[model samples]
Target chain A: MNQARRGRPRDAQVDERVLRTAAGLLLERGYNGLSIDEVAERAGVAKTTLYRRWPTKDHLAVAVVARLQDDDGIDDTGDIRRDLTDYMEKIADALNRMRSAGRTAGRDDRSAGVVAELVAAGARHDDIGEMGRQVYARRNALALGLIERARLRGELRADLDAAVLLDQLAGALYYRVLVTGAPVDRAYAERLVAAALDGAMNRKEIPPCP
Target chain B: MNQARRGRPRDAQVDERVLRTAAGLLLERGYNGLSIDEVAERAGVAKTTLYRRWPTKDHLAVAVVARLQDDDGIDDTGDIRRDLTDYMEKIADALNRMRSAGRTAGRDDRSAGVVAELVAAGARHDDIGEMGRQVYARRNALALGLIERARLRGELRADLDAAVLLDQLAGALYYRVLVTGAPVDRAYAERLVAAALDGAMNRKEIPPCP
Candidate 1:
C-alpha cells in the first residue's frame, strides 16, 4: 500500500480541485453546459482521473451540491429559534446561489436553475439519487440533533416531531424556489422559522378543532 | 371568429381529450417515454391540433399537471386545521401518484419519478415555468382565502403570515418527495398539520428565545 501511494498525489487534494472546478462550471454555465471534459481541462487533471471519480455529469454536479450543503453545517447556539433561523438562512443562501446560476446578475429570473437539474439528476440515476439522499440524511441528522437537544431541555414540546419541524423549515425555502418561483432571502427564512416555531392559531382563543 | 370556428369539434372537448390522453401516457411511460406522436395517435387528434394547443412535450406535461392540481382543489369546511390537513393529504396523494408512475407497484421505490421530470421541464423552459407558477398561484389563492376566513373568526392569529403557513404545509410534502425520499401519506400529513397548527414550543415553559 505504501509503495502504491508513494508517487500519487493526495486523493483529498485532487478531489477538492476537481470539485471546485466542476462547481465553477456548473454555476457559470448551468447544468447543461457543465461538461466532464471541460471540468477536467479547467482543473488541469487527467480525464481518466476525473472520470474515475465521477462517471457522469450528474454525479459531478451532485457532488458539488453535497459539498455545498456540508459547508452549511448546523450551529447549535441553545437558542432554537435563532439557531434554526440561521441554519435556514444558510440554506436559503445556498439555494439562492443555485437559483441564480447561469442567469443575469440583477434580472428577476424565476427559473429553478441548477437546483432543479440536481433534483432531476437524482431522479434519473439510482446511484446519484441514493448519494443525494445520503447527503441530506447526514445534514438532517445534525439538525435533528439540535432540535432534540432543545426538546430535552424543555425549550420545545416533548411531543414535537423533529423530522417534520426540520422538513417545514427547509421545505419552505425549497418550495419557494421549485414550486412558487419566489425568491428566498434571509427575511423569508426568518418568517418561515417564526411561523413554524409559533403556531398560527391565536393563543387567547380556542383553535378550530372540528 | 365565426369562420375560424367552423365545426372542428368543440375546443373544450378537444382540450379535455388531449390532456387526458397525454396524462395517461405520461403516467404509463414516465416522462421519457411520453411521446407527442403517440399521444396524438392515441387521442385520435391531428398532430397540428395538439401542437396548436401545447406546442411542445414540456408544455403538454405541464398542462397535465396543472389539470391534476385543479382537480385537487381546496376543501374549506370552516375548520382550518382539518381543512389544511385534507388539502395536504390531497397534495401528498397526487405527489405519490406521480412518484409511483411508470414504476412497478408495491416495490420500495424511493425515486421521485415523473414529479422530478416535470420540475426540470419547468426549469428548462421559461413558458413552462411561468405556467406552473400561475397554476400554483391560483391554487394558493384559494388556500389563502381559507386562512383569511379562519383568522376573521378568531381561529388563527391576527398577524399570522398566511403565505409562510401555506408554504410550510405544502412545502413539507414536496420536500419529502424531492429531497428526502420519504413517503408522504395521510398519517404524515396529519402529523405535519398538527405540528404547524400547535407548534413545537412547550408553551407551559418559556421557549428558548434569546
Candidate 2:
C-alpha cells in the first residue's frame, strides 16, 4: 500500500488522494455533506483540479465507490457449501463495517441519510456499475457453482434454477442490511443458506393448499 | 377535490396552500433540489408560516409522504401467494410512478431523493419509531399473516419462519427499486414468491446419491 502511494508520482488523471479523502469524508459526513473544497483541502490539491476531473458531486461519488470497490475480487474455495457460507457471511461483515463506519460519520443525524447516500450511489452505474456487477456476479456464480456441484452429486433437484434460487437467498441479506441495519454474521448466513437449499425446496410439486 | 379547491376564509392558522405546493414541487424537484422559498411562493403564503409548521424541509417531506401514503392501501386477496404477488407488484408500480414523476421534475435524474427524505423522518421515534416502522410493519404483518395461513394449511413447513421468508422475497423488489432502478413486474414477484415457498431451499442437507 505504501509502495503504491509513493510510486504514483507521474500521473495526474484522477486524484487518488482526493478520492480517498472524499471517500473517508463520505463514509463520515455522508452524501449530503460532502463538498469539493473539503476534499481538495484534505488531499492538498486545488479545487479546480478536483472539479476538472469530477464535475459534479454525483460523478465524484461514483469515483469514490470505484476506488473502494477494487478490493471486491472473487474468492474460490474447493468446498462450495463452506465457500458459499463464508462468502455470504463476508457480505454481512462488509455491511456491518459500512454501517458502523457511516454511524461514526454521523449517519444517525437524519434517518440514516449517509447510508441512503451509499444506497443511492449503489443505485446507478456510471463507471462503477461494472465493478458492482462484477462483485454481485461473482457472488451469483459462487452460488450457481455450489448448486451445480450439489446437483451433480445428486443433492439438489435437477430442475432447480441455481441462478434464481441464489437470488432468493441473497436478496434477503440486502433487505436486512438496508432496512434494519442488522448484523450479518456467520450463524445467520448458515441458517439462510441451509433453509434456502433444503427446508423450503419442494420438488414434489405440491398443490397450493387451500 | 374540486370543493376543497375553493378559496379559504381569511386568518386561517394553517396555510394549506404552502403544504400543497411544496408537495407538488417535491415530486417535481426531488428532495435535493426543492427549497423553502419556492414552496412559499407557490403557495402564496408567508415564508415564516411555512417554517412555523415544518421546522425543516425534512419535516415537510415526511408530511408529504404521510399524505400520499394515506391515498394508498394494500390488496387483500386472501390467497397468500396471490396476495403477496399483488402487493409486491403494487409496490413496484408505485416505484414506477415515483420514477416517472422524478424524471418529469429532474429532466434526467430519476431518483426518489424526495421519498428517501421522507423515509428518513421515521428513522428515530421515541414512542416506536412510528413513521417508517408503521408503514413497514403493516406491510410485513399483512404478508406474514398470509404466510402463516399457508403454513396452517400444511402447504409450508410447520417450522418455517414466515417473516424471514417474506423478507427474502420482498427484499428483491426493494433492492431492485432502490439499487438497480429496475422495473419489477408481476412476473418477477410471482417468481420470487414461488422460489421462497416451493423452490430449492436446503443448502446444507445434501441428498444422498442413489
Which number leads on TM-score? 1
Clashing pairs in 2: A196-B201, A196-B202, A197-B201, A197-B202, A197-B203, A198-B201, A198-B202, A198-B203
Query: What ranges in model 2 sit over 4 Å off?
Result: A1-9, A12-25, A28-47, A78-81, A102-113, A121-158, A161-163, A180-183, A199-210, B1-53, B70-78, B104-130, B201-210
Highest-scoring model, lDDT:
1
Which docking class does model 1 fall in? medium
Interface RMSD in angstroms for candidate 2: 5.2
lDDT of 2 by residue, A111-168 (tens): 4334455555443333443444455555566557667876777656666766557665
TM-score of chain A of each: 0.90, 0.67
Candidate 1 lDDT, tens digit per residue, B1-210? 263676655877888888899899888878888888899999999999888888999999999999988987787788998999998989999998898878774457888988999899999899999999999999999999999999999999999999999999999999999988999999999999998988888887334444
lDDT, candidate 2, B89-120, per-residue tens = 87766665555444453334434344334434
In candidate 1, list every pair of residues with a backbone clash: none
Per-residue lDDT tens digits of candidate 1, residues A98-168?
A: 88887774458899988999999998888999999999999999999999999999999998999999999
